[model samples]
Target: MMVCRVFAIFFGNCLCLLLLLSSLADANQANIDCLKTFKSQVEDPNGYLSTWDFGNQTAQGFICKFAGVTCWHDDENRVFSIKISGFGLRGVFPQGFKLCSDLTGLDLSRNNFSGPLPSNISFLQLQHNQFTGTLPPQLAQLRRLKTFSVADNRLEGPIPKFNSAIITSESFANNLNLCGKPLDNCKMTSTNSHSKVVILAALGGFTVTAFVVGIVLGFFCSTISVEQLLFRKSRQNR
Candidate 1:
């Protein structure tokens, strides 16, 4: 009975180990898919992404060797960040980057990517690009974002209010039409102007009413004083 119990314990340990390995394999596969989809969508005129070959599954951390990819470990397939600045990559924002579940830092600055940015990304360094359209309001929801910049782009409209001390006007420089906190306030709409006009008109009416009431009170008090003085003088004469 003791020998049977020992065998059961060993089997349980083996099962746990297999489960851990399986989970890691699934995560690594997702990372691989992220990179593959990103590469297929962009235009790499300079062949900067040519080293991202997926032909060898036998090699450990093969994806780590690809340019612009940063892995959590040299022998692991997990991606930590991707920085591919100045690569002249032209395309809309790559949506497949969401598959890299562990990605924390992303720097694609100085590229030719143009379009609305993805709202779900947490970190961004997309300056000097050709991206256009209003900055997505949903970006304010990324509370964990530590680094963000979209300067020198063609983007317009009210900038999202990201409540980060590190974010300042410099992070949004040269965007001709962007407005909000850390920048010029957005233009007041016609509705706001109308509200201001109504407020001023009410104040003016109140002031005119108060002035008329004051004059009436002053005239009435003067007439009462004159009557009292005349009555006293006539009583004294009698």
Candidate 2:
């Protein structure tokens, strides 16, 4: 009976180990699918992503060998970040990145990607791109974001109120219409117009007051000169 109990315990441990391996395999397969889908979505004009050959599925960390891909481990398929800056990649923000559940950092700067970005992004570096549209308000929710930049883009409207201290005017520079904290406040057109009107009114009032005072002084001086002339003529007649 004791021998049977030992055999049962050994079989249970093997089953548990197999289950864990299977889970890992599934996660790795998901990551592979994420990359494959991402590559299919973008336009790689420079052939930079050509090394991403999906032919070899048996090799461990094969995806990590692809250009611009960073893995959490040398021997694992878990992606940590993807830095594909200046690749001349053109496309709307790739939705395939959502499949990469482990992705933390993404740098697509200096590319020609246009259109709005995904609102649920946790990390981003998208400077010097052709991206347009207002920054999403959901970006303020990224409290864990360590680095963020969207400078030199054609984005417009009020920037999200990010709480990170690292964000400054430089982070949002050259974006023609972007405004908010770390940049000029939004809706300043009306304030500026009102200020101009007030200044013009003050100048007009000052000019009118000065002209009235000059006229009063001139009239008083003219009257005194006339009296003096009349007095001199009277003396000459005497």
Candidate 3:
């Protein structure tokens, strides 16, 4: 009976270990799924990503050793960087990058991808692709961007606001109709105070107009009352 009990305990422990490993395996598969989704959306120039084989297993397989893909250090459960630029890729911008929360580097330059630029993609080499659209205002929220490039696309419009200082003037050139300081003379947008003042002035004008109309109406009524009283007295005298 003691031997049987020992065997059961060992089996239970092994089962627990297997469950833990399975959970980790699932997480790694999630990273691969995110990459696959991005591949479908972005147009690959020079067919750089055509060699990727997502069907393989993540561990002891070609997915882990896939070129241009660097997974997390100490573990293959997440992706770290994708530096494949100047490969002549052509397609629309990939919108599923938000799923890769741990991404640090993304090099998709010299590709033919076009879409509204930026949606909280905080990266260093994520630029240089063929993305075209109003500079997404959310890009200013990415606090980790460095050496960003969208300079040579069909992008246009006044530059949106952001908290980034690393970005330079060259990042936004050769566009359709971009106008601003250091480029053209599109007046920089006003601050919060300026917008508030404009709103207040419009409201104040309406209030003043209403007040003036009330005063004029009151004066006219007073004159009419006086005329009625005087007419009554004159008729009584007659």
Best by lDDT: 1
Off by over 4 Å in 2: 188-238
| 2 versus 3: better TM-score goes to | 2
Cα deviation of 25, candidate 3, in Å: 3.5
TM-scores vs. true structure, each candidate: 0.78, 0.75, 0.62
RMSD of 1: 5.6
Candidate 2, 132-169: lDDT as tens digits: 99998999998888889999989999888889998889
Tens-place lDDT digits, model 3, residues 1-238? 9999999999999999999989767766666777888888766656678777776554543444656777776446477877767766666667666666667888776666677765667674534555566777677676677657667777777766655676667777677766664467775456766998999999999999999999999999999999999999999999
**Model 1 local distance difference test score:** 0.93
lDDT, model 3, position 112: 64
Q: Compare the candidates by TM-score and give the number of the best one.
A: 1
lDDT-wise, the better of 1 and 3 is 1
Worst 10 residues of 1 by lDDT: 54-63
Query: Which stretch of 10 consecutive residues in model 3 shows the poorest summed lDDT?
Result: 56-65
Error of 2 at 206 (Å): 32
lDDT of 2 at 98: 86
Ranking by TM-score: 1, 2, 3
